[model samples]
Target chain A: MATILVADDFHENRDVLCRMLRLVGHSTISAANGQEALDMAQEHRPDLILMDLSMPIVDGWKATAILKTTSDLRHIPIIAVTGHVTPDEINRAISAGCADYLAKPVDFERLLGKVASLLGDTQRPPFLSS
Target chain B: MKLSIRTKLLAALGLDLALMLILGSFALNQMSAMNEEATFVAAQTIPSIDTVNTINDILLSYRNLQVEYIINVASADKLRIEGEMHHLEEDMAKAFITYDHFQLDENERATFEQTRAGWEQFVTATHTQFIPSNRDSNTGNVHPSFSRLAPLYDNLLSHVRQIKQQSQQRATTALGRVRAAYDASRLVILSETTLTIVVSAVIGLTLSSNIARRIRKLRDATMAIAGGDLNQTVALRGSDELQLLANNFNLMVASLRQQHLLLAQRNTELSESLETQRKLMSDLVQRKQAEEAADRARATAEAASQAKSMFLATMSHELRTPLNAILGYVQLLHLEAQIRGNTDMLPDLERIRSAGKHLLTIISNILDFSKIEQGKMNLEIDTFEISSVANEVIGIFSPLAHSRGIDLTLICPPEIGLMRSDAGKVRQVLFNLLSNAVKFTERGHITLTISHEYHSGKAWIFFSVADTGIGINPEQMGRLFQAFSQVHHNTFHHYGGTGLGLALSRQLCQMLGGDITVESETGKGSVFSVCLPADIGTVQATRQTHVLHTNGNLPRHIPGSVPSLTPGEETAVVASPTSMTQRDA
Candidate 1:
C-alpha cells in the first residue's frame, strides 16, 4: 500500500477522502488545511499528497510552490485537487510543482487509478470500469 | 412755338435772317421811293423851272423890240422889227416844246395851253396886224397900231408870266413832297434797324441762357454725378431739351438712391456672413475634437468588452467544488452500500446518486461550454481502436438496458480497427448517444453499431445507436441539439436530466471533426449516429496514391467494400453480436 496524504479544509471532505483511500488499499493521513498538510507532508514524507487547492492558511498553489522549493519535500509527488478543472487552473497546479491534476468532487475510480499509477505500485487492481 | 432744341436754335437764326430780309426790303422800298422822287426833280421839275424862266426872258425882249418899232420907223429899227418878229415866233415855239417835254399834271398842262394860245395871238398881231403888210416903211402904221400891239404884247407877257409862276409853284410843291418822303423813309429805316437790333439781341440772350446755359447746367449736373455726387440736381426750366434732361437726371438720382439702399443691405449681409464663417470655424474645431474623443471612447469600450468576455468565459468555481465532493462521496457510499447488500436502501441511495450526478453534469456542461467559448476545449488526436471505444460506450448502457428489460446490442465491424482520431472525444460522444438511447427506450432494444468508412479520399468511423422505444417526433427532432432544450417537454419528466447532454455532446463531436445526426419518428424506433472524420493526414495521402495507382478511380476502403485492419499492432474490441450487451434486430 502507498502512503497518501489527504489535505482539505472541510472536515467531512477530509474524512471521506481518507476513508476512500484506505478502502483502495492506500495508507492514509489527514490535514485540515494547506499548512497542516505541508507540516504533515514534511513529517510523514508520504508517497503522494492529495492537495485541495481552495484551502485556507497557505493554499495548495503556495504550499506546493514551497514544497517544490524544499529539497526534503520536493520528491514527494503532489496531485492538485480543485473544483476548477479549466486548463489554465490545471496548468497552474502542474506549473506549481504538482505531478498531476484531479478535478473535484473526485471520481473515485479515476482518482484511485491516477494515484496507483503515480505511486508506481504493481499491486493495485486495474480499473475495470468499462 | 413749342419747338425741339434744334428747331428752336434754327428758328432763332431764321428770325435774325428774316429781320434782316424785312429791314433790307423795307429800306430798299423806301430808298427806291426816294430815288423816284429825286429822278422826278432831276428829269422833270428842274427842267420845267428852267424852261419857264427862259420863256419869261424871251417875252420881255420881244415886247421891248415892238415898243422901239412903234417909236420911229428907221431903217435899222425896221430891219430889227422883222428880225424881232421872227425871234418872237421862235420863242413862242420853244415855250410849247418845254410844256410838252415835262410830264405835267392837269393844272400845268392847262396853264401851258393858256400860255401857248396867248403867245400865238400876240405873235400873229405883232407880225401881221401891227407890223407892215408889205415890205414898205411902216412907220405910219406903227404908231396907229401901237395900241393894238401893246395890248397884244401885254397879253403875251401876262400868259408867259402866268406860265412861269405856275411852273415854279409846281416845282416848289414837288420839291417839298420829295423832301417830306425822304424824311419819312429815313425815320422808318432807322427805327426798323433799331427794332431788328433789339430783337436780335433779345433772341441771342434768351437762346444762350435758355438753351446753352440750361444745357450747361445739365452738363454740370451730369458731371456732379460722374464726380460721385449723386445728390446734385440740375437747374433747368421750360418745356425743352433742358427740362427733359432735368427730368432724366431726377430719374437717375432715384435709381442711384435705390442702388445705395441695396449696397447698404449687401454690406450688412457680408458682415453677417463673416460672422457665420467665424462660427463655422469654431464649430468645425469642436466637431473634430468630439470625433477624436468618440474614437478614443470606442477603443476603450472594445478593450473593456474583451476583458469582460475573458472574465465571463472563465467563471468562478464556488458552485462546483462542494457539489463535486458531495456527488463524489455519495457515489462512493452507494458503491459501498451496494457491496454490503443493503438491498432495502438501494433505491433511495440510487435516487440520491442519480439526482446529485444530474446536477453535477449540468454544472459540468456549463463549464464545458465556457471552456469551448474561450477556445480551451481541444481534442487530443491520436490512433485509437474504434470498436473498443464503441464497446466501452455500449458497456455503460448495458446495466440500464438490463434494468429496463431492454436488449442492448453492439454490431462493430471487424475492420473498424485503429483509426487516427480523438478517441476520448469519440467515446464522450458515443457515451452521450448510448445514454440517450438507453434513457428513451423503455422495452424493446438498444443497438450500437460501428462502420469503417472511406469516401472522397477521407476515412470515417461511424457509430450508430438505435433504440426501439418511445421515439422522438419529427417536430421535436428540430431542436434536439439546442442547449438547455429537451425534445417533447414531457421527456424531462419521464427521463430526469439537465437537458444539456445532447448539445454538449454535439459540441464535443464537432470539436473532434465529427457530427451527430438523429433519425426518429413518433411511436417508432429512433437511430442516432455519430460520424467522425478519421485522421485524414496519412489516410488521404495513401488514398490519393492508391487512386493514382488505380488510374483516377476511388480508393479501395469504401463502406460496402471495406478492408480488414492489419493484425498485431492493436487489439480490436469487436464483440460478438449476441454478447451480454447484444439484442436481435
Candidate 2:
C-alpha cells in the first residue's frame, strides 16, 4: 500500500477521492486546491497524486508541472481528473505530466484501475474484490 | 454714290469712246477742210497760171512771124509766112477768149486787161498800117508801121508776162494755204489722239486699280482664315462686289470664331467629366475595400463566439462536481448501512442518490442542449438489438409506472433486429419519453413499441412511446420541441423536469439521421415516435453531412461483427409493471 494525494477545489470531491483511496488499503491525504496540493506533495512526497485539473489557484496542470520538475517528487505519478472531458483537455492534462487522465464524475472502478496500473501494483483493491 | 465695278468700267469705256469719237470727228473735219483747200488750188489756181503762160508764148511767136514777113523777099516765103502770121493772130484771138473765160485774181485780171488792149492795138496797127506797108515791100511807111507794131508787141508781151507773174503768185498763195491747212489738221489730230489716249489710260488705270485693291484685301483676308487665323476680317472702301464679298467674309470669320470657342468649351467639359468618372471609380474601390474589411471583422467575431460557447458548455459539465460527490457519498453511505444491517437509512440514502442523479441529469441535459447549440455533439455508433433497448427503457420506467399505478409495456417485435446507431442517445430519448409519460400519467398505461421497417429502400428502426395519460394541448404542440419551452407553465411544479429533454431528444434523433414526431388529442392520450436509420454509418456516408466530432474527435464505432437478434431464451423481458413492483416489494 502506497500513500496518495487527492487534490480538488471542492472539499467533498477531495474527501470522496481520499475516502475511496483509503478504502482500497492505500494511505491518502487530501488538499482543497492546487496550491495546497503542491505544498502537501512537497512536504509528504506521496507515491501518487490524483490531481483535479481545475482548481482555485495554480490549477492541476501547473501543480503537476511543478511537482514533476522537482528532483524528489518527479518519480511520483499523477492521475489528472476533471469535469472538462474534451479530448483537448485530456491531451493537455497528460502533457502536463499526468500519468493518466479521467473525466468526472469519476468512475471509482476505472480510477482504481488507472491508479493500480500507474503504480504498478498487482494487487486488486478491496472494493473490486468484494 | 456706289461706283460698282460694272458702272465704273462702263463709264471709263464711255469716256474713252467719247474721247475717241471727238478725236475722230475733229480729225475728219480737219481732213475735209484740208481736202477742200487742195481741190481749190488744183482746180482754179493751176489752170489760171497755165493759161497766162500760154498767152505769153503766143505773143512772142507773133513778134517772130512779123519779123519774118518783113525780111523775106521771095513771094512764096512771104505768102507762107503771112499765112503763119494770120494763123498766129487767129490762135491769139481764140487764146484771149479762152483767157477771158478763165478765173483770175484781181491783180491778174488788171494785168490781163492791159495785155489784151496792147494785143488789140498791135492787131489793129498790123491790119491797117503794117500790112499795107509790108505789101509795098521797100516803102518807108512800112518801116514806121512795123516799128509801131514792135513797140505794141513788146508792150503786150510785158503785160502778158506781168499777168503770168500775177497768176503764178496767186497759185503759190493757194498752194501755201493748202499746205498750212494740212499742217493745222495734222497738229489737231496728233493733240486729240494724245489727249484721248491719256484720258482712256487714266480711266482704265483708276478703275482696274480700284477693283484690284479691294479684291486684294479680300484675298488677303481669305488667306489668313485658311491658315487658321479666325481673327482676320476684311474692310473695303467701295460699295462694289468686292466690298460685299469682304463683308460676307467678316461674317464667316465671326462664325468660325464662335465654332472654335464652342469646340474648346466642349473639350473642357469632356476633360472635367473624365476626371469626375475617375474620382467615382476610386470611391467605388475604397467602398469595396471597406466592405471586405467589415466581412473579416464579422468572421473574427463569430469565431470568438464559438470559443466562448465551447468554454461555457464545458463549464456546465464542470458544474456537476458537487453532484458527483453527493452521489458518491450516498453510495458509500448505503454501503455502510448495508454493512451495519441498518435497513431504515437505506431508503433515505437511496432518495438522496435519486435526487442527486436527477440534478445531474438536468445539468447533463443542459450540456447536451448546449452541445447542440454549439454544434459540438458527437455520435458513438454501435450495433445493438432494438428490442433489448426498448425493454431496458421499459424496465427503467417500471418502478415509476408501478408507483403511479400506470401500466408500462414494451411492445417489440421479435424480428426487430440489431441496428447500427448511437445506442446511448437512443436510450436517452426513450428514457425522456417514458419518464414524461410516467410523470404526466395518473392511471393509464405507457407503452413503448419498437419495430424495424424499410423506408425509401433504407432500413429504419422506430421506437414509439404512446401513453393513455394526460394528453398535450394542440396549441402547445407547435412549441413542443423548443428548448426551455415548458408547454404547461402552470403544471411546471406538478411535473418536475428541466424541459430540455424533448428538444435535446429531437436534436439527437436528427443528428442520428432520424427525427422525433408526436401526436396527441386533448384530454385523451399522446404518442411520441422516434425514427432512426438502422445504419447510421450508411446514412452518414450517403448524406455526407457535418454530423459529428465538434470537439475534433472522430466518431467512435465498436469494432465487432454485428450480432443478430432472434426470439429465443436468450431474449428476456427486462421489466413489466407487476414484476417490477413484486421485485421492489
Candidate 3:
C-alpha cells in the first residue's frame, strides 16, 4: 500500500477522503490544516500528498511551495483537493507544485484513479510500515 | 455766534461798523463843509454885494438927474425953472437914504453922502425961482424972465455938472470895492467844495475794496471745496461776517473727514467678513463633495461584493451538474464490470468516457473564465487567414446542426487575406458563439456572414452569426453579455451553458478596439455582430483581385481527439462467448 496524506480544514471532508483512500488499499494519514499537513509531510514523507487549497493557517498553495523547495519533501507528489475546482484554479495549483488536482465533493472513483496514477503502486516508505 | 464764531462775528461787525462810521463821518463832514460854504456864499458874500451895487446905481442916477434939472431951470423962464428944481430936489433926497444904507465900507458911504449934498444944493437954487413961473403959467401968460435967465442957467448947469462928475467918481470907487469882495468870497467857497468832494470819494473807494477782498476769499474757499479738497479751510481775515463763515466751513470739513474715516473702516470690516464667509461656504461645499465621493466608493464596493456572490452561486450550480454526470457514469462502469463474468459494454463505456471528457472541457472553461476575471489571460498575436478560421468553426457546428434538422451556412468574401490577431482567442470566441447557436437552435438555418468595408483609409471586416430559432427577450438581452448570466431563470433547464462565452467575446473584441453587439427578439431570431480591422493584405485591391480559393473540396474532421470507451466495454465483450460454457458446466 502506498502512504497518502490527506489535508483538509473540514473534519467531515477529511474523514471521507481518508476513508476513500483506505478503501483503495492505501495507508492514510490525515491533517486538519496546511501547517499540520506540512509537518506530517516532513515527518512521514508520504508517497503522495492530497492538499486542500482553502485551509486556514498556511493554505495549500504556500504549503505546496514550501514542500517543493524542501529536498526531503520535494519527491512526494502533491495533489490539490478543492471544492472550487476551475481550470484556472487547477493551473494555479499545478504552478504551485501540485502534481494534479481533484475537486470536491470528490468522486471517490476519480480520487482513487488520480491516486493510483500518481503513486503507480509504488513501494511504501519504511516509516509507513503497519 | 458763540465763542470762536461770536468773536469772529463781533470782530466782523466791529470792522463793518468802523468802516461805515468812517465813511459816514467823512461824508457828513464833507456835506457840513459844503453847507457852510454855501451858507457863506448865499448869506454873507451875495447879500453884501447886492446891497453895495444897489447903493452905487442909486447915487449915480440921482447926480445925472440933478445936473439935468439945473440946466433946465437956468435956461427956462422963471415958472419952468421952479418946476424942474422941485423934481430935482425930490430925486436928491431918495438917493441920499439909499447911499446911506447900501454902502458897506465907510469910505464908500462918505462918497455917496457928498454926491447927495451936491444934488441938494442945485435943487435949492432951482426951487426959489420955480414958484413964480408956476403962478404966471397958471394966469395964461409966458414970462419973459425965463428967456432972459438962459445965460445964467448955462453957468449954473456947468457948476452942477462938476458936482455930478465928483459924485460919479466916488460911486465908481464903491463899485470896484464891492466887486473885489464878491470875487474873494467865491474863491473861498470853491476851495471848500473841492475838499469835501475828494474826502467822500476816498471813503467810498476804501469801503468797496474791503468788501470785494472778503468776497474773493470766500469764492476761493468754495472753489477749493468743489475741486474735491475737503480738507481746505476758508481762513478769511477780517472783523466781518466772512470770518464767521470761514470758521463754520472749517468745522464742516472736520466732520466730513471724520465721517470718511468711519466709512472706510466699516467698508474694510464688511469686506473681510465677506471674504471669511465665502471661504467658509467653499470649505463646506468641498467637505460635502468629499463625503459624496466616499459614499459612491462604498456603493461600488457593495455592488462588487454582490456580483462576486452571484458568481459563486452560478459556479456552484455549473460545477455540480457536470460532476454528477461524471461520478454517476464512473460508478455505473465499475459496478457493471463487476456483475458480468466477462465484461465488454462498449456503448455504455463510450458514454461514460465522453461524459467525463465533456466534464473536463467544462472545467477548463471555468478555469479560463477565472483567469480572465483575474486579468491573467495573455493573447498570442499572429497572422492567419480569417476565412479559414471561420470555415473551421462552421465545420464544427454543421454535424450538430444537421442532426437537429437545421441548416448551417457560412458566407465568406471571395479573397479575404491574412488577419493579424490572437488566432487562438479569436478561434475560441468564434467556436463558442457557433456552438451556442447550434445548441440553441432546434430547427431553422444558422448563417455566418462575413464582409469587408473600407472607411477613412482603413479596412474593417464585419462578421455576423444570424440564427432563426427561439430568441432572447428584450429585457434579458442586456444581461446576456454579462459574465455567468443566463437569459432566464429556467435557462439551465432548457440548455446547459457556462454563459461566459458572450462576455469573453465582448472583452476580446474590446481589447482589439472593436466590440460585439447583439439583436434578438423572442421567437423571431438572433443576430450577433463583430467588427474588427482587417489585415493590410486584405485591404490591397491587387491581392483581392487574385483568384479566390474556397474550401468546397476540402475534407473536414474534428480538430481534437476523442477519448476511448470505459472499462465496462471490455467486460461486456469478453462475457458474450462464455454464456454457453457456463450453462454446459
TM-score of 3: 0.44
**What is the lDDT for A22 in model 2?**
81
Model 2 agreement with the true structure over B105-152: per-residue lDDT tens digits: 687778878888888888888878876778658432336667876677
lDDT (Cα, tens digit) per residue for candidate 1, span B132-152 = 643455445546665766776
Task: DockQ for candidate 3, please give it.
Answer: 0.04
Q: Candidate 1, DockQ to 2 decimals?
A: 0.39
Is candidate 2 or 3 superior in DockQ? 2
Q: After superposition, how far is residue A114 of candidate 3 from its true place, in Å?
A: 8.4
**Candidate 2 per-residue C-alpha lDDT over A1-130 given as tens digits, one digit per residue, 9 for 90 to 100:** 8999999888898888888778778999889888899899989989999999888878999999998898988999999988876555788998989988877777667878889888898678544566
TM-score of each: 0.52, 0.55, 0.44
DockQ of each: 0.39, 0.41, 0.04
The 10 consecutive residues of candidate 1 chain B with the worst lDDT sum are B543-552
Ranking by lDDT: 2, 1, 3
TM-score of chain B of each: 0.48, 0.50, 0.43
DockQ-based ranking: 2, 1, 3
- Considering TM-score, where higher is better, how would the candidates rank from best to worst? 2, 1, 3
Cα misplacement distance, residue A37 of candidate 1 (Å)? 2.0
